[model samples]
Target: MSTAQALSPSSRAESLKKLEETELDVLVIGGGVVGAGSALDAATRGLKVGLVEARDFASGTSSRSSKLFHGGLRYLEQFNFALVFEALRERSLVLNSLCPHLAKPVPFIYPLEKLIDRPYVGLGIGVYDVMGAGRGVPSHHKHVGKKKTLESFPSGKRSAIRGSVKFYEGQVDDARHTMMLARTAAEYGALCVNSTRVIGFLREEGRVVGVKAVDLETGRAFEIRARQVINAAGVWTDEIQEMVGGRGQFQVRASKGVHLVVPRNRINSSTGIITRTEKSLLFVIPWGSHWIIGTTDTDWNLDLAHPAA
Candidate 1:
């Protein structure tokens, strides 16, 4: 078992306090992708940074993502051009420049059922492919007839798919990637201590300055001073903001998305698939050993400490 899995929350907290008092330029709270990225950004920018996480890294929504680092294809339907384009750029950068070893390309097959659907879906997918072409990802997706589509995916009925468009996107092991990011930030001189809970904010002159945290393992408490504090606490962002008396500019709405994992061999497919959901999109992503499926987007009002499956 990893040390992360074995460490008591109290013990983790004590270590963090000892590390935090050792001097730092920036203190980042949370250890999800955004927080970890922030720490890395601060450290790389020549700031002495410290990062504390209340749980093992990526133990939140970051690890529970769809795992695709892609330009949102469905977002095009809503005319979310800016988001799509920006994501395409970031996807390429991550796959090629940032973390090639962790991010790799995967093909997805979009099945078209009707003749008219082909032109419409093809056009949108064509634009998507073109927008991302010449990036680190593949150039263009190919259109395959029903015969080829069925040949490619043995599990689907021959009559089920009129044709299929195969496109590519990037994938990553979210947990591993997140951990590596934290590790890399630490390597660059960021003090990263997991299992340290930020109990409250240190304030002065009606402004936030630092944080008072507890070592969940040893039950010890300490204070770390910083010029600015970033709350990348995701689902708990509001709670963290409340700790500092709730004076933030933005409010977060909670949504729940659930994914199911099944053996890859159970679903015979040459590539992954995407289908339109009533509220959003559903994907059958091909993980190395399993096929990750199901994502239901709905309002969430439950215990965030344990996300409902």
Candidate 2:
């Protein structure tokens, strides 16, 4: 069995932090990827760890992601070698070892509208696909002519689309995967409790120490002490730092991305599609009985909780 699957329910319960505990090896704030990762890493190393979140796990940017485990194709256009390589490696790990059940191969088709568009787009995508060859997902392939293209993607307007190129990428249940990370960390003995808000920081001799928090459910205050603390609150990161009485090093901007889900029959296509927009790449991802589209990225300042269309 996989390491993640081997983790039992009883082993996944948090027990490292007792109520009113005064000390711990590590305290992780924010229940997102990095925070949960730190807690799991620390706990696996035999350290007493605690992870507290003010809301449900992955209830922020993590859950609002595009849900793809891919090396961004747009990043390739900028010649970002390091970023592509790193992301490709991470994607491979996720598909092969990390969460095979949650992540799977997804084929996406790039519609070639013009005759000249094929060579240019195909060549670039070809290089990208070759780079990912032998990496967990399948290599990219192309199709031409109305018959072949229609055979591959019957839903497309054959008159508008000269042909299409088929490529494989990875998709994941982002929320489920992130929650699995938290559960895995708890299995390793990390004390994790959601709905516990961190109000302030605890200090001694002007040195950093623990956190003063309140249970949102019960409205009770408590102090969770630890030798070191990690902040992994994605968008609210700056807010957490401010409460600690320290100015943040860099500012974080909130970008809202919204996805619209429609039934698969609305846009009947054999494979998913990725098209270039003025500002961002638009993906028509297939999700079983439904197809997810949109993902409009707008500067959000009003309420980080919800993004307006």
Candidate 3:
């Protein structure tokens, strides 16, 4: 949203020229948060850098995440303590230090359904508190009775609200956050260019030295030389690896997810809600004056650019 930091026509032209003329220390593929963060890190370290993405920033899964930057509290039930700790720590860095402007605390109420589920759920949340202790976020959970639960979410079906547990998590405008990362890297002297597709890798004696890219808008191909190339192309990662002509260490799989946005008045909730589906958990997150309810996660086999309803 910051125009001076945005990718402009003049800036893109200058970056393309720089890519063709300068020998970079790092050439980052993909313009998602991972790619942008890599560019920022490399540029801040005083390395010459270039970033290319086939589409807009966060056009992929980076924008479609659960949108919560929390320490996966649900994972506590599975005994994944380390993962939860690590995620919460990162969440702290983002909310408290990294980019506080793009993210903030959002509260969620996990309503209890069956009478027998309280003890187990409470214990899991207890472990969540332990893992998240000392992090900037509040580690304690608020026990809410059915009366209080109804006060928070009056539109909830009566049968579903036995009681509730309130907790806090960080939420971000993912698309905006991603663009800011790319722009910040650009401000730090990384030649960040989106809508540029990597068609092939530039090689010398069986080692990758750069990339051959084409401007998606102009259809003109250009070669860029670099000491190292990083593939952060997300779902298309395997394709880049194949172009590198080597057996990949791990494969990337694409998962399709979709979110439904509804007016805030429809839910009539003071706090967001979290519920479990048969296979996964669904979040009804508070989004300003709107509520986001979503998301179906299944292996994607159709078009990568668009998914069917």
Candidate 4:
């Protein structure tokens, strides 16, 4: 496994020494995407920064994202155009500038079950395309006849799809993308340390200052002092907040997502596919020589560290 740019033993020791010796501008907890991004932003502004992670980078929910950076067209029912547009903008940036090699286009087929539904569905999709305006990624949706749809996705039942609309969306390697963020943050001078758990917070008076952490590998304890401390702990945010003697404004409920990986040969498709379900959307994404099919979302009440399938 990749250590996500962790330092050597001596280097880690030196980093620990520096953390004690100097007061940093920012101390970020968690090694997920948000934490990595925060570290990068702080370091880029020439701020002294330190980031600590409880486990390997992207070991948490960051690695389990749907792997697609997309504007939710389905949100149109709720008139969430602003959110859709904003998402599309970010998707374009990721595909065009941030991490082009890791994010690419995946075609989706939205099957239409009735002839009468054609014009309405097409118009909505058109609006969805327009919202993603100016994005270098393809924003056009194609109208495909029933036969053509089957030719593209032979596995789909013909009765369910009277016709189909094909459109392009962004896909990425979630784990790798998140890891790259941490790597880039480190490159920009953020001290990225993984396998270091925050045991408690260092509070002075009514405000927070830093954290008391344990190096999991060496079983050594250390303190990191900073002007600002950020908790990008994802689902564990509530726990961290409670540790500081205050319940955050919001509570975080953990959701377990499940995905299945299968060989490419098993799924006959010219492009990736997303179909509607009673409770949610099912996406079959094309990964390097395989297809990732699933994403069953439900409440999780088990172990936070290791959620069983």
Candidate 5:
């Protein structure tokens, strides 16, 4: 096991020196969740790993997420059982063993608007609960009558909401969760540095060998050599691929997701509420002192770094 390493200024300086002087077994691009997790995985296996990020950790889509570890109930409507099952299993692992301190079970109420909606929604939730059985969370869902629903969510429209089904999903602070992933990876001997941007790829004989990078903090350019490089840049994958002079095997498209945060009192609900929207599902999640409601999904082809709402 590797000893814990604090990601302090001194440690960062040391890591920067090491990154410049040493040859790495694996180098990871991006500081998002996937990239940080990849570094952690590689370092835990005793590889000399280095992770570089162009900005602060989790400053991208990793931070701008719904912050829910949910088994996509909407996917159930599409009959995607396998995906939901896998997601719930992962959710259980995260809540039960991975980062219980950073994650927990949050109950959500799927409000029914019509009488016929009960049986259908309940059946789907029942299957969801069953599929998620023994996966660390409460595996049963409860159907609440109209009176109970009103009692739980007084702000809910009495005339519109018929009843609701309550189920548990995992909640986490996505930014903190991602930052910890990077810190843990550093603890496991991964040389993680942010504010370092990869500008070009170092290639020989048509094979990638390393990267040409610049430290955005100091405006110093350097090269990092690695036996293997993994790109986990999320939406910026295509741009990274471009540095190598070709389109990658696959392309990445960015989807803009917009979420709104309002005071908790704005929605008088004891638990979260999930409802169907015309284009997609809507979530009114309970935050510490506020409720997070969103998101609108649409294709985005503008600036990747800064997207206007």
Candidate 6:
């Protein structure tokens, strides 16, 4: 077991000094979920690892997610069974074995509109439940009539609904979860430093060596030498790749998603609601005293760092 390490000012200074001085087995860029997870994985495996973040941890798309650990119910319609299965397994691991304290099972109701909607939606959710069985959450889904559906979601329109199928999904505060991941990686002997930006890649004879970085707080430039450099910059991934003359095998595009939060009383729902839109799925998720609704997807071609909502 690894001892807990505090992400304090002293720790940050020490980490920075060590990063400037030592050579690492793996150096991770970005402080999002993927980068933090990579650092944790490397450190736990007894590899010398270092993680750097441009801004605060989870300050980008990682924190701006829908925050549900669902098994992609819509993926079933696309016949993407492998992706769905993998997501369900990861969701189970997160809720049960990984971050049980940071995540929990939340019930959601998929409301039906037409009489014919029951069997179709029910079949889908039934398959979803079966696929996710014994993975952590409740293995079965419940079907409720209109009366019970309205009872559960009193704010729902009366004329549009027929019945509902209820299923379970995991919920989390994405920011805290990601921050904890970095801290845990640090505890496992990975040097984690946020507010540090990688300006360019350090290359030797056309092979990447490490990175040239700047500490945003002090504006001090430094170099971190490592055998391998992993870029997990999320939306800013392309920028990192470009620093190396854009030789990366893949390119990344950015999408902007917007969500609205309203007081819980405005919805009058005890459970979350999922509905179908013409283009995608709509969710009215229950969060504390408020409901998180919406999520408009659009192409983002402007700023990668500070995206306007």
C-alpha lDDT score of every prediction, in listed order = 0.83, 0.80, 0.86, 0.84, 0.91, 0.90
- Pitting candidate 1 against candidate 5, the one with the higher TM-score is 5
Tens-digit lDDT track for model 5 on 32-63? 99999899999989999999999988999999
> TM-score per candidate, in order?
0.93, 0.91, 0.94, 0.93, 0.97, 0.97
Ten-residue stretch with the least lDDT total in model 3 = 1-10
User: lDDT tens string, model 3, 127-190?
Assistant: 6766777466654777788889998899987877899888888899888888888898898889
lDDT of 4 by residue, 261-308 (tens): 999999788888877689777788888898988889899998998877
User: By TM-score, is 4 or 5 better?
Assistant: 5
Give me the runs in candidate 6 sitting further than 4 Å from their true place: 1-3
For candidate 1, what is the TM-score? 0.93
Could you give candidate 6's per-residue lDDT for residues 119-147 as a string of tens digits? 99999999888889847786579989999
| Cα-lDDT of candidate 3 | 0.86
Clash list (residue pairs), candidate 2 = none
- Error of model 2, residue 184, in angstroms: 0.7
Candidate 1 — which pairs collide? 9-216, 9-217, 10-216, 10-217, 10-218, 11-217, 11-218, 13-215, 14-215
User: Which of candidates 1 and 4 reaches a greater lDDT?
Assistant: 4
Cα-based lDDT at residue 212, candidate 5:
94
Off by over 4 Å in 3: 1-4
Q: After superposition, how far is residue 70 of candidate 1 from its true place, in Å?
A: 1.0
